[model samples]
Target chain A: MKKEHFQENCYVSGHTACAGCGQSMAVRIVMNTAGKDTIASNATGCLEVFSSKAPESAFGVPWIHSLFENSAAVASGVETALVHQGKKEGINVIAQAGDGGTADIGLQALSGMLERGHDVLFVCYDNEAYMNTGIQRSGSTPFSASTTTSPSGKHSTGNPRPKKPMVEICAAHHIPYSATSSIANPKDIEIKVKKALKIKGPKYLQIHVPCPLGWRSDPSQSIDVAKKAVETGLYPIVEYEYGKLTKSRKISSPKPVSEYLKLQGRFRHLLKDAKALAEVQQVADKNIEYYGLK
Target chain B: MAQAAKLCRPGVIAAYPITPQTHIVENLSQFIADGELDAKSVNVESEHSAASCVLGSQAAGVRSFTCSSSQGLILMSEVLFCIAGMRLPVMLVCANRALSAPINIWNDQQDSIAVRDAGWIQLYAENNQEAVDLIIASHKIAEDPKVMLPAMVCVDGFILTHGMEVVDIPEQKDVDEFLPPYNPPYKLDPKNPMSFGLLGTPDVYLETRYAIQKTLGDVLKMIPTVGKEYQDKFGRDSLRLIEEYKTDDAETILIAMGSVCGTIKDVVDSQRKQGKKVGLLKIVSYRPFPKQAIKKALDSAKNIGVIDKDISLGSDGALYSEVKSVISSDKKISGFIAGLGGRDIKAKTVEEIINLSEKEENSCRFIDLNKNILWEEFKTI
Candidate 1:
């Protein structure tokens, strides 16, 4: 689809999102695709708090602000209502949550909604930490990433655990649709979203959205950083259906893990420590071999 | 005419059966099944789904109903706040029962008392007639445009809920005349689409809560008007908020809620015949607290004994503390914990408490204290 054909006017715009925030860009692009017929349920996070401050909402479409953990549940209720009333044809229900909201607090409700098979699209805009609450490490935060809560110090290393494989969790539910997309590739996101809309049951799409504010990178380098995550096999774009992995975007000449790590200050400490760097490379290789990205 | 006035209104009802509270759902289900009530009946899997079903249906601009008790209420607690916060005006019939520790199923106000801050308007019934009538009145009050909050008619489990009595169930025409079709401010209309519960930042979060608070606070004013309007048609003038029994010439009063009020009233009548200066004050509205009416009822009493079926843990009984907060500092108030976990709160126990209040020595006591199985003396057991 042509970029101009995508709705020029988005539901959320002219907000105080930091310059080149991947979440803000993804919201704009996704809402544009979702159009006016969408009722967006946003978890309490940066996107929700920044855009839809009451009396002055950036959204043109119907939007709900729900608790951080229950955006999916709230959207399920909304979808159930719409379906019961026989008004589900044109109206689309979309639940958008950040990494912390989706991967941590909102996981149970999300799982419940998916298991219940509500006809709603849940979008996890993964910026990798609780950015709205000041760069705290979340379940989606990568290993060796230096977040405020998981800071590297004399006594401790950065985040010690690997990022949770959310796509596998969604796939385990035997959901009709689950995909990993990225703001770095808007076309992939747009295609996955359109494909998800055609499915009859709960659909999940986790978009790799880099946050310059939280990732400690140059604001302009957000998209580049996101792309490197894909190219280095740290974040492979994959899709699944009926409990089976169906498609994956393969990377030609996959870069070493160091290429992705050196760009962000969160991973800067790992460069000086060979042990930490080796562990990071092991995670990258595991993701590459698991997704069959190469 | 009274039979016509008590007919079921047109709407959708989804419910589940819980112990002690099953009768309310059973009666409503029968009403729908018999073709007397023009409503859709959904037999949900659990109280949580029952709440969700009604909330969803109500959001679609349809009036809906559900009922539950104790553990069931707690199971549906999360969705209760959702329905109220969304301003859906859904009405529920709550057969108040004791919460689980030992898991005994019996009559008590503990169930509804635990959910006191859930933003739903709670109206307690003293008898079967009030149980049926209050359910009708709650629909009217909740659906009022000025007070678009969820309402629960709390009937004592097994006591008023299961106990059969002569209730004048109104006819369909009277119900239609009294309760109007639900026309929500913003529903899930495809043509005129709007968000129901949108996220708000610090810029507008406080205002949303304030709006709900103000609406709830102002809803008390509409209760009397709505109550009076119902009475004009039904010929029963039920108290809109709190009911006082023999409170006029009493030196000592027992303040309680739910069906225990009936037990206390019985105790009060026999005590009054013997020239005892004891009275009973029954709290009808638990949410919004009925603070002003509570203060007025206990204003002249020398000693106020509060009987609570619900414990607040770390503190005394929940209602006792709420009542104490409303009364003047100089007033002597006693907090007694009774009927917890569905333990029997007999009339004799209430009568003994009332008599004890007259002595002016022991202020508070736990009724039916099992001394043999005491925790302090249980090491050798």
Candidate 2:
């Protein structure tokens, strides 16, 4: 089961996370690819909660965890300080946060960092909902997905809004680099981090990590669920340079949207509602058209 | 304050534009642009980012600075607590101003007072000289090996920030000897890897707070030595937590902080000529509360009055509450809230405050208030 690409795993041992947590894997790949010369500012979330439990840390790299809303802003500070020491060239600064931190509370700071062109890489681990806060609906949550706060009932169809265009939002800032990545594609995760580290200005890479706890999916099926999300054309693995879409991972076997949704309990109610299921399929169809998925 | 920053030579300055606070950062930017200061300056998007920028740089072990006032201070309050809780020695200047809702942009201490327990060493400057001197001394006090907590020097918005004065600017070499380089014991280093400001479980969270509180107590003792050292080296008396102004043999004393102390002192001098037994006690450091010095300063006075430019809403002024807690005596100390939202506090107001305290029992008094206007609003409500 070993992938073609492997890293040194900057996110080390002695931590608490679900056995098959895809987000933790993404953290490992991103940081390892960022290398030993990286200093990180992490936001408060499951990553922060599990990695640091007082007097013990899972981070093998030099890291700092500030409030959830200021991780990117703090990274901007770290970058400027490196500039002061004439060490910006030698060190790489990275910001790590969950979907809630990136798309909602931390968005302003992220936009500011990108607009100001601080030489730092911002990595948003998009696990759909605020999984750490008991599966509350976040801006990045997919449409009709059942989160604790957005539960399906007689009057409700879970989240009414579609998934936030996080990568597009980063591109809108006209940053030097922006891309979509996932743990399912470990090669892409490492490749994007390597590419971002080489860029001289603000760059963003958002990895669509599947949360087994929030998704109510089988823990062992995390990789399958992540792979199915891409194969179904629901989550595009695309890259943008300076706001222009330059590259996208071609989907050769575009599975029906049901292949992805049927695996997770969050979307189980959609099976009974044909109209809602069609709405979800239409979203995947549009992504397939836009991304030119085969 | 900007000149003091220039002398201290922080590695980075992160600032956002806020009224009364804008000029300090503007000048820092101008210095960096003019090739006068070698530090990297960031005109951040908001006070929150400005504070985060400092947090980031300070974690990297490079000294940094930021400034804000009123709404800007409130915006930065979240990160203010983060900087202290993280145990980083960052410097922030609070150009003290009144909070909004009425949208006033005048001098008041409400903004800084609101974040009193944010774990920062809060110092108030009475005039331009103290503003300049305290800003210079802040780096030393905050960067003390024992006390790595951040410190904020609050200069009244418009009063010290806009009001010009002749300040004795210290030489760069002297400040260098005084502050040296900010070589923190621990820093964000790639080689010697470590995590900072990590999550504290309930097991260790209380101890972290206890450590900061104990370090703050250590600051009260260490800060005076820093001021004394500044005096010995530069021939200027600095670093006093509180300054006593003619309190000896006085029947009543007026205690205050920030620029209003100057007006109180002027009133005290004139009242002395009229054979009035009145004195002034100025609080230079508000965070540590300086209980010992406050007690010693107001010992001889039979009656006490506290002038606060900031209040704690339902309760009286914050200073009034703390002063009352420290001095557990039968002597009544009247609290007056005045000069709010940048309203003027003339010498006559100081005289009236002293006069009222001598005649009345302890209570919260509003100075220079238009009662008719307030009553009109009440009728409309």
Candidate 3:
């Protein structure tokens, strides 16, 4: 099918998401690219609760909402079922969850799905925190980022650890494709998603999505923040295939983590703490040096 | 005459072996190996995979089955909700066993009870016969277009699963007649392909859940019809939901589920001769929780007590809480926690519960509490 045909009106119009919700836009683009021949398994998170309220649907394609975890497992089941029915050809299975859902709650299921090598694409829209549940800190919540559960105060710092390296974890499974993308660059996300679809075995794509509500940033700044995340080398856009890092976005001079952190209130506390700021910079430098983005 | 049922009914049989539940997978594997069943038998590494395997298989528009026990069932907990929410009519045989800490491998309802709200329809079996029959019925009920939700059949761990009775296994032809070939309304077919799960915004998420709720509500209605059809095919009449035992004139009734119901029935019969107005209400279908039948069964009893083989930690028994919710309007039912951790729930224990219910005082008591243990006494010393 033509890419334009795949793009024709898949995600339902009139969603209840906040203005410039990165996850909403990411799902819309992904679903459109997935086309009509694709089945989606969504885990419980901002994307699921916001789009699938009772009596209404933001999905024009057939859809299922499992739990906070196990979206990949559910997607695997769908793939297996199709294979059993002699319908595995051309049909694509996509499992989508947010950072909280994938990095923390869904890690095992996602690992299992990738390890099993099912013909499916698993996407982790990394919004950092558990945005659907009042911004609780998740495993994907970055270091020095304040959340309801991991608040920054005199006694305690914000989330004191770097986010779990999910793409690396996916890579460890030796799947056919694993990538990290950002909503800041739709073309990049679309290219990676399209590339993932072509790979025979399981594919994983971690999409950096800025959450206004959880990040305590302006809604309209979603894409901009996501872009700054890439530019700052805090969230490098990279892809791996066959257990090897195949590609990464080039950045001649990476911006400082402070530039990315300065825009959000969740990271506002980190500005005052010189030690925490240094630690955050260390994380960014590590990502930039590790992915060779600079 | 006992006849063999076709194993071909299930398009996919995904399972992980646990005590008591080993037989279901063993038998299914045998059938598949022997070519008696034309299905894929996925021996999953974990119960989680087993449940997930069935979920994916079901979404592909095929009949699926899985089996698990206490820890195994608990491990499958997360996927259970997914199977139900995805509206896939997958069937599972949960061989009931005690939850751990002390680690008992015997019979109890704690495992299935932990997953009470996982959105799957749950059924309890009183005997090996019911275990086999209810499994077939579960497939029918789950696969029903109106009831496109996963279903679980709970058989007492060693009580029924290990205890092999002279079960009149239905003829494959009869079972086929009773349960037609499962053709899913929507499947992942390339020709008429569709998405199984999609991203939903808030404007539509509740609607998806409502649809699941509506389907489950519909399953409650469809279960009876499926059970009746099975009964017509096989000469055994199964109570599609709750089964009442001599409860008509009883002033006090003991409510229980799983294989314990049989033991409770025997106890009730012996007590009835002693002039005790005691009866037994065996909850067969735990989910789509037979609210009306439960209310009717316990409505007339002067004192009602629910014997729970499962505990909900700080709260009362899960089954007891559900029973209380059902009988909230008219009854003041007592909750009894007993026979946990695969502990032998002797007939005397059930009889004691019934006797306790008869009293105006001591209504809700832990039946088998270790009286020798006293936290306050220990702390003072």
Candidate 4:
């Protein structure tokens, strides 16, 4: 631990993740916090495709990518194997996936992993939609946001459903720890990841990672978009321990949902429809009241 | 099967319950509960997780195991290919059962045959004793550094899985000596960091598959050597690729796999007792298909009757087509599809198939079909 020696990045710069990619930033922070003694089981998504392409891998730690919906199960196996080998003392196992891989297809395996009480951290990088598949609607896609599958038209206002309560669902599993953070707050993400890795059971950390390509926003504003989401009370940064809320980030002065929506093209149609705009505002208002974000 | 797996001393066992595969995992659970075996047995949520769990454990350098039945095998099919492509030496027991539309849970070979091309070594057992022997031998065979691939020991559901006989479970000390602890060449270790299951671009993806294909061909030679070594140690000759029963001097030979081979052997014995030139050629290794051994076994036969418990739907029996591909063009081979959806392939059915192969050269004949019900159903089509 010499002060002069710079800490080498676990996630290096050569990865093909797009510029200002919120998921890449979140992954870099998480990996750096977990450090070199970590093993990561990644689900098939943007992170896996961009980081581990043939002949070149961006990971500085032991990394494995299985199918789309089994990272939790695979991490459980990795933890069990390490325990079996008497090597579980200092190592950390982390399972990571996108929103679709977590809230939708991967939910069953994640539930199983948590129920089994494996000592691993499961991270869901919430990018809103299936950004790797060119922006399709997912369970985590917000209400009134237009994607390729859920397009806004005269008859419809994009995705009819609100974002899935993923952190609440994970908290319902009665795990040791579960939390929501954002790429805009890498310090919080780093602290939560470090804390979760120290607990003795499954922990969930869902990070709000805005995709510039999918959101049709400027790449430079990716962190700004994520910050606006938290400031508007739409994506409340919160934490739960043993199915009970322990903490939440308060919005000192809550901004209008329009400020967050106006930055991204996916929500452009909502501005044209007053009813849809109000509905979107209602989602943020409800979150603000429920989690006491304001 | 559970005793054999326990003897192999797998560091991890993960499985989900489905039909006849349940008993195998249940027994393993009991062993773990009783402290008879020191292992981590994970009861996963589904067959897909069961397979993936073992894949993760095996990739982390522990010998892992899982078992499933028809639908469960199909559910685990994707991960089966992944485990093979990643070159993990995991062992699985496939209690073969019929697939559902009608939803029958009885014994059938259709399930294991369905995943023949998933790159796992597929071994079919004719009885419980052979099932036990194969489970133990598969660990050694699959764990060889030269042939590091996942293996499936396919035991017929309810037939070998549920049926009990006096099986000589090997001593744990002997099994340990026979099959040493699995030492993987590469693993998920922080001490020596490595990335596995990476996206193989066009430049490397094709060669990775080619390596597996080439290794499987090498496995065809290595199985007999391992089988002979096992026989030398255990005094049972049950792990050969194909078993020849009086095929040398027979005019007609019947080929089959799994527990149905027991019935074929019984019919073959009676036919030989009556001075008939009939024999049995049981397929033990179904995946590398045993083409050369099959070609050698059927060299002198005038007629070959392949009693397949599964079919290729539009074409013919899978085994019959494979057998036909290896043999000379002059050989008369008839495929008899029977015991589908767990319809009993009785001794009478085997006799009928033998008689039919002599007079006709039918490719996909459904034996023991109730013609009245079939024609009644066929009228609508």
Q: What lDDT tens digits, residue by residue, belong to model 4 across residues B1-381?
A: 898999998889999989988988899999999999889999899999999999999989999999999999999898888999999988999999999878999977888888999899999999999998999987888999889999999998888888878989888888888998888888999878889999999999899999999989988998899999999999998999999998999999999998998898899999999999999999999877788899999988999999888988999999999898899988899999999888998899899999999987989988877766766757453
Scored against the true structure, residue B23 in model 4 reaches a CA lDDT of: 83
Flag the better candidate by TM-score, 1 or 2.
2
lDDT (Cα, tens digit) per residue for candidate 3, span A1-294: 222433465686566788778999999889888787787888887787677665456766667676777788777777877776777787788898999879997888788788877889999999999888899998988888999999989887788788898998899888889999999999988888899898888999999998898888888788899989999889888888888998999888988888999999999988888988999899989888899887
User: Could you say which candidate leads in TM-score?
Assistant: 4
- Put down candidate 3 lDDT per residue, B1-381, tens digits, no spaces: 011223337777778778877877787788778887777776555788788778877877888778889999999898887677768888887888988877889888888988988888888888978877887767777777777788788888887777868887777777777778998787655445354555555766788788887877777787777778778788776647888898998888889888888889999899899988889898888888888888888767878888888877778888888888877545547888887766678887887787677665332467776656757665343
For all the predictions, what are the DockQ values?
Answer: 0.23, 0.85, 0.30, 0.84
Our tally of clashes for model 4 stands at: 0
Q: Alpha-carbon error at B218 in model 2, in Å?
A: 1.2
Off by over 4 Å in 4: A1-7, B375-381
Q: Which ranges of candidate 3 are over 4 A from the true structure?
A: A1-7, A146-158, A212-225, A255-279, B1-8, B26-36, B40-53, B71-87, B113-120, B185-225, B239-256, B261-283, B286-338, B345-362, B365-381
TM-score of every prediction relative to native: 0.87, 0.97, 0.81, 0.98
Worst 10 residues of 2 chain A by lDDT: A1-10
Candidate no. 4 TM-score: 0.98
Candidate 1 regions with alpha-carbon error over 4 angstroms: A1-8, B1-86, B93-108, B157-173, B188-210, B234-239, B275-277, B295-303, B313-316, B324-332, B361-363, B377-381
- Top-down DockQ ranking: 2, 4, 3, 1
| Weakest lDDT window of 10 consecutive positions for candidate 3 chain A | A1-10
Q: What proportion of true contacts does candidate 1 retain?
A: 0.28
lDDT of 2 by residue, A1-294 (tens): 111121355777557988778899899888888888899999999999998887877777789998989999999999999899988887989999999999999999999999999998999999999999899999999999999999999998899999889899999988889999988889989989998999999999999898899998999989889999999899999999999888888898789889899999999999889999999999998998887766
Which of the two candidates, 2 or 4, achieves a greater TM-score against the reference? 4
DockQ, structure candidate 1: 0.23
Candidate 2 TM-score versus the reference: 0.97
**Any runs in candidate 2 off by more than 4 Å, and if so which?**
A1-8, B376-381
